[model samples]
Target chain A: MKARVTVTLKTGILDPQGKAIEGALKSLGVAGIASVRQGKVFDIELAGADPAQAEAALKDAADKLLANTVIENYNIEVRS
Target chain B: MKARVTVTLKTGILDPQGKAIEGALKSLGVAGIASVRQGKVFDIELAGADPAQAEAALKDAADKLLANTVIENYNIEVRS
Candidate 1:
């Protein structure tokens, strides 16, 4: 099975890196760019796992390292 | 509008950080976790912006700072 984990920052958190990226975009002549927020995606391959088991494993991954849990949230999707 | 940018390593990239994270998870007694891939996420609120504009802006941000482009890929989602 294959799983993808997406982790993102919650709203109201100040993202200086994102702001810097936004400024760089504007300076590069990329118009209409108001702002930028950056996040993470993780794709993992799990050998010999059932869908339900893989999802549970992915959630465990989220809790452990995929998300900060302090200022971020995570979601998982499993594919055969 | 609000936009979220997700950046991840392309397959075939050796992610040492992800491997370390996976090891940490295993040590912490989080069972069933076979592997882990670490990535980055960003979220931004664009006041008074259209979805299309926000997406284009996000692509520009990706090109500038959100992604390495050499070994990473990025995806964007916009919400009103």
Candidate 2:
């Protein structure tokens, strides 16, 4: 099974990297870009066959190590 | 309009960050995790209503700034 974890900054958090990206895009002559929010993605391969178990384990992983729950939110997707 | 860009390391690339994440997950007692790959995601808001134009601009941004074309692949999704 494969689990994808997306960890994104919560609304109202300041993202310096995103701001830098927005500026870079503008300097690159890309127009109409208003804002950018940067995040992290983790693609994990598991040795399990049970989708439910994999999802649960990934969620645990996200909560424990993959995300800063105070400032970020994480979503998990499982594929088998 | 909104565009989401995902930047991932190419296959066979050494990802020290991903390796560290894998070790962290194991230390956190999360089982069944075989391997981990880390990537970046950017959620971009654009000032245009045209999906086609937004997609093109985002692709350009990805190629120029969001991704390293030599070692990373990027995927863009546009929403309106």
Best by DockQ: 2
Residue B43 CA error for candidate 2 (Å)?
A: 0.2
After the best TM-score superposition of candidate 2, give how far the Cα of residue B78 lies from its true spot, in angstroms: 0.8
lDDT of model 2, residue B32: 94
In angstroms, the error of model 2 at B58 is: 0.4
Candidate No. with top lDDT: 2
Cα lDDT tens digits, model 1, B6-76, are: 77888899999989877887787766667778887776666555687767766876787668999998878
Q: What RMSD does model 1 have?
A: 2.7
CAPRI rating of model 1: medium
Chain A TM-scores for all candidates read 0.93, 0.96
I-RMSD for candidate 1:
2.9
Per-residue lDDT for B1-80 in model 2, tens only?
87789999999999999999999988889999999999999999999999988898898899889999999999998877
**Which ranges of candidate 2 are over 4 A from the true structure?**
none
